[model samples]
Target: MAVKLRPAGILLAAAGALAIAMPVLLLLPGGGGAVPRAAPVPAPIGAGTMPVLARVYERPLFGASEPVEAPADAPRLVGIVGRLNIDAVALVKASDGTTRTLAIGESVDGWSLASLAIDAAFFTRGAERVRVPLPIEPGGSEAGTEETGR
Candidate 1:
């Protein structure tokens, strides 16, 4: 019996041989150094700080709206009357000088209290969520003395 190779078989055999030789070729001397590693790890833009993403996700089905920017006359968060709970209320003084205590999910005027933290309260109007920080008292403390969650 005589051995015979078809075009497809020969091409396949050549491909297999090359595939097997690749690792060996890479291991051989004079191969390029370290295969040039995928474009160095990418250095952070600022002092080891990764860029924060500011994009807001909107869920149309859930009636979720995009975060809205607080207007210039937005009410100022004066203080947190309670801890983070159902009973926790945010003391907000509006532009008209009327102060109100608002619990979570409560709305005053057109602003709805969305969340409350230790030093700040978030209000939502339409698709916008605005964060109001507690104002510093004149005798309270220096501005830069405390960390503001930068």
Candidate 2:
């Protein structure tokens, strides 16, 4: 039976031969002498000492920091749909007189809708938060609610 050498086998055999021959060739005279190592660097006199750094206080990027009521020009919450917080969306009337439907994490007029409830939408900008509740109609019901006469 004859054994045939495949292309992969031939390449692997060549690699093995090169690996075996490399060390022998390097050991031969003037065949790239042993590589010289770098000298150790000495530490400076005060290298072990750490300098005293001033304490830095960073302001919080989120959460209410004495949040005031929404400004008169701020967007108004017109209505809210969906009961679950995750799926709820708020309809807002922006200062530009355009009505926008916003979901949690959605932004309108630079304020992001951080969360939503059945009757209100909470928006945040930087550390300031504003809660906009659905306006109540003259019938004493929320704007989006129907009067059942009960």
Candidate 3:
């Protein structure tokens, strides 16, 4: 008779074969149009048009700063703000801390991400969020033709 298998049962069958191979090692860097997307019911970046704020704007005018410039796999800083720009995800801290979100795609100089409606009191903890109130003609604004999110 024989029965042999240990190393914590071969590392518990190699950690259950790597926990069901963790979504194939996270979709193996998705190359064929990155799978798992199916939320279509008349929505693909429209209904008003706006989307671009990968994060980094509690205050950043002209020189810009902060730990912003997300998408390093983006956990949440999916970006967009208007009322000029005030949603680093509405300072994301809900469930009790009372923060909010709804600025989908606010564009002005994002070159045409086209969406704007930001205003969580314009986030002024130390100021410098924006100001171009009717005076800007360098590239001549066409990213949504200024509804006022620039």
Maximum-TM-score candidate: 2
lDDT for each candidate structure: 0.77, 0.80, 0.40
lDDT of 3 by residue, 93-123 (tens): 2224443453434322221122233421222
What residue runs in model 2 are displaced by over 4 Å at the alpha carbon? Answer: 1-68, 143-150
Superposition TM-score, candidate 1 onto the true structure: 0.46
lDDT of 1: 0.77
Q: What tens digits encode model 2's per-residue C-alpha lDDT throughout 22-44?
A: 99999898796878989998888
Q: What is the lDDT of residue 36 in candidate 3?
A: 77
TM-score (all chains, Cα) for each model: 0.46, 0.48, 0.17
- How are the candidates ranked when ordered by TM-score, highest leading? 2, 1, 3
Among the numbered candidates, top lDDT falls to 2
Clashes of each: 3, 0, 10
For residue 100, model 1's alpha carbon misses the true position, in angstroms, by 0.9
Candidate 3 RMSD to the real structure: 23.4
Candidate 2, residue 117: CA error in Å?
Answer: 1.3
